[model samples]
Target: MTRDRQYSFRKVTLDDLPLLAAWQSAPHVRQWWESAEPYSAADLADPKAARWIVSTAGRPFAFMQDYTVHGWEDHHFAGLPKGSRGIDQYIGDPEMTGRGHGPAFISARMNALFEAGAPVIATDPHPENALAIAVYKKLGFEPAGPPEMTQWGLILPMLARR
Candidate 1:
């Protein structure tokens, strides 16, 4: 698909569930995604979960999930200032891997969140997810703290005036 036709960051909807579920279960794709349990159509249809489908040319390719950090209250990071937001994403299609879509999708999502008044965004990945860590760093996300036993913490650089 042409770069111009890619849907880097679009809100996900119920209609895209079937495609999303398939991608999530793909062997290659499942390695990085934590949700391995069966996901029902009703789960996707639920509005309480704020998620987005990343795609190109109107075809769904990945999933992006975000929520208020305070609401989940997970103690993944201790040094980050309070009021930070968390962002998580996974490329649903294994065939699309290593084709240069991750960074573009992340940039688009970050821009959208920043514009929406989010001062900070955070993502945690297993240390072995080197490819994803590389992509995160390439997108200007700096390591926030030392890597925990299983996960590494990363934070996007604060917006700076040009």
Candidate 2:
């Protein structure tokens, strides 16, 4: 975590799907993600969601997405304060993991969201996903509730408030 990292998030486009698809199929990402399928037309067009290609020093290395917490019905984070948002991400390049990039990029995006007036930011990692939980905690997220079954599957809800 000592090395300085400069991260950037660029909006995802259709052309990036092949790269994202490859990442989604990686063993590390597949271990916890529900589906490895790249974005469908509907997903890409969803007005409430934002998908991004995460990069460091101009090299694309990860995928990320965020959305309005209450944008969907039955959403786990809907109970959060109005203007809250939710985030999910993965480092596509195997070499990028365990090197502090997760916290660095997530913090950058989270801070941007907060500065843009979001009241809270939420995340839900599978209960067994210790790596993700650790990263979230490192980024100031606290467990908001116990595990719950949502459309996304079982998750341990966590939150960080601005």
Candidate 3:
């Protein structure tokens, strides 16, 4: 396991769009994310989703969100058990990528979800995203199903059971 680091999460707000946009523009983020689109007004209005900015030592460096797997009728993760949650995130700052924050913050967040009664925490990393897959695997996530396509794109559905 990667060494744990202290990270803080803050709910995203209208005031954060500019900073998020800048992070999305980074080539490292754009390579897989393609676009930096984090949230829309509708996304913020939805009680099912939680959007956040991840920071360390008081400086934000990543974006993360978790939502109900069954929130969308046709969503890929809808088949998961009710109350199961799905998460997606990116280390917007490339500088933070190789430093272990991904697994550390993500594991911390998933642990919280488990403690809150989540039966399983799901993740759908792109099939070719080895780095992301590694991070998930290191945190005990395993393939829940084969790779498949959805409205967002292709994904390898994975889950960490409680």
- Predicted model with the maximum lDDT: 2
Q: Which residue pairs overlap in candidate 3's backbone? A: none
Question: After superposition, which runs of candidate 2 have C-alpha atoms over 4 Å from their true positions?
Answer: 2-4
lDDT of 2 by residue, 1-162 (tens): 655778889999989999999999999999988788899878989978899999998899988899998998879888888899999999999999888888888999999999999999999999999999999998899998789888899999999988
Give the range where candidate 1 is weakest over 10 consecutive residues by summed lDDT: 153-162
**RMSD value for candidate 3:** 1.6
Stretches of candidate 3 exceeding 4 Å from the true structure = 1-4
Candidate 2 Cα deviation (angstroms), residue 108:
0.5
Return the lDDT, model 3, position 90. Answer: 88
lDDT: which is higher, 1 or 2? 2
TM-score of each: 0.76, 0.96, 0.93
